[model samples]
Target: MKITTPRWALEAAGAIGAEMAGTIAATGVRVVGDTALLSAVPEAVEKVPAAPRIAPEVAAQALYGALAAVASAPVRHSAPAKARTVHQTSSKELVRVLGHRCLKRLRRR
Candidate 1:
């Protein structure tokens, strides 16, 4: 039978989680701590399609691995033009508040 990951699982994992999950699947047997070997956890997790259902240990490994890689990457000191423009946008967005009247209308739906 063909196996595929579900939409809900992908959504929960988000961009980062999806990458991490893929890594976990690719690296079947990984050495976690000094004496701990996560040889079977990834395989067990792959048998299932849901991300949330994955074992905590496996998930932790994926998250840590992804985070560490990101942390070690080189940093860019300058922001792109688009990002700079957005950062300098008007402060109107911060002051605007949707009062009770707007909330009541939304609740009707």
Candidate 2:
């Protein structure tokens, strides 16, 4: 008995493999099937732009400055809370109210 993979599954795998290959190529890294010989393309390396590196000291100083600015900022006080009017109902009253609504619904049906 021969077990075969679905066409869509094969196509999806091919697409994913192609994308992986493209990404690896874009990164200026070469994958060779043979382990004996490996070569790097200088042009490929030059093609990818290097990101600017920030010094740790400068980053720390900027972070500290931001924190200090935030700490020195004035604290705004909110107005006092207004009293709330709450109508509390007992469990028995709630059940009675719900039962009346259900009866009314059933009568209409």
For all predicted structures, in order, the TM-scores are 0.26, 0.29
lDDT of 1 at 57: 95
Tell me how many residue pairs clash in candidate 1. 0
Please give, for residues 4-103, the per-residue lDDT of candidate 1 as tens digits.
5675554554655556656776788674543212221222235544456778999977865554454444433355546666455434421222233343
Q: What pairs collide in candidate 2?
A: none
The TM-score measured for candidate 2 stands at 0.29
Model 2 alpha-carbon miss at residue 71, Å: 86
**How far in Å is the alpha carbon of 98 misplaced in model 2?**
58
Tell me the lDDT of model 2 at 29.
65
Give Cα distance to truth, residue 68, candidate 1, Å. Answer: 0.5
Off by over 4 Å in 1: 1-52, 79-109
Model 1 lDDT on a 0 to 1 scale: 0.48
Positional deviation of residue 39's Cα in model 1 after best superposition, in angstroms: 55
Clashing pairs in 1: none
